[model samples]
Target: MRFQWLLIIPFFCLLTACSSSQVHWRDISSNAVQASAAEEPLSLCRELYKDEAQIYQCEVEMSALLRARQQCEKDTDPSYCVLMAEYTWRHYKDHVLEDSPDIKQAGNYPVMCGYKENQITPCSLTK
Candidate 1:
């Protein structure tokens, strides 16, 4: 009985060790922001990942956000457009930082998706 108890304890310990070790998004974003310079736009996302694919993704996302910011300046509803752009930036920032399990779910609002001309589209459901 004592030997069986010892084996069970080890098994539980091993299971605990194998559990997920994902870092929280806020901490990762905070660290990345601190590592970057104020003058550089891409630098804000550079520390989000180490692999080439992920780095490229960060660059792409940052570029799109920058474009959106520029467009917002010319938008009829500049304040609303700019606010949505900033929100989108934060959304993708969290996406790059979390690196956790899949966040998408059926019927869920598409938050990672982008807007168009200061308006969020796809209001109607699709198959």
Candidate 2:
């Protein structure tokens, strides 16, 4: 009986350790989806702003906004990313209106800005 208990204890410990090391499928899938979505807004911004300087700025801003959004999602604090997304969206909108009035008139700014619900969603993943 003593030997059996010893074996069971080790087995239970091993099981716990193994389970802890296992990756959660839901987490993996969610990460993939989020990563894909994050790429979309950045790509759209890149394509929309042909100017090298403008594209660089857009990329930097988009990256920062996406990172903030991801952190917000993880922390359950929507303020940071939400504000960043809104600000980024507005900044791009103003930039387009100022530089390319035709694009703004055609309602292309939103499409080019690539955000939804004031959040940076992956434009590529979105249809």
Candidate 3:
């Protein structure tokens, strides 16, 4: 029984390590999302469309996600950064437009970090 307790201790420690890393990654991605959502083209787009009359939302979100992904890449693995960016972007978008039923539909983005249709546009992850 005492030896079992010793084994359980390592298991708990391993769990804690995994949990901490998850939390750290989450925090990094979330922070990047929030910050990118508020800066540059996003904010500019919002200001330009205070009435929300157009579908500029897709472009805005793509820009913000790209910015967030870049920030996450700077702080962690590139592939993981992509996942984190998409996850946090979805989270942020869901909360921001919680009442808008139409916002639930996914927009046209690229399948990866790079642009697909136009180089002048923002990167998307859903080509």
Best by TM-score: 1
* Clash number for candidate 1: 0
- lDDT tens digits, residue span 1-127, model 1: 7789988999999898655343333334444334334577566555666666555555554454444444555555555654565565557556754562222321122332124544444323211
Ten-residue stretch with the least lDDT total in model 2: 21-30
Give the runs in model 2 whose Cα sits over 4 Å from its true position: 1-41, 84-127
Alpha carbon lDDT at 69, candidate 3? 62
Q: Which stretches of candidate 3 lie over 4 Å from their true place?
A: 1-55, 96-127
| Per-candidate TM-score against the hidden true structure | 0.34, 0.33, 0.31
lDDT for each residue of candidate 3 in 1-127, tens digit (9 for 90 to 100): 8899999999999998855412123333344455466655344444433355432553445454555565444332456546745765566556755543232333332223332223322333222
Model 3 residue 9 CA deviation in Å: 53
Clashing pairs counted in every model: 0, 2, 3
Q: Candidate 3, clashing residue pairs? A: 110-124, 110-126, 110-127
Question: Which candidate achieves the best lDDT against the true structure?
Answer: 1
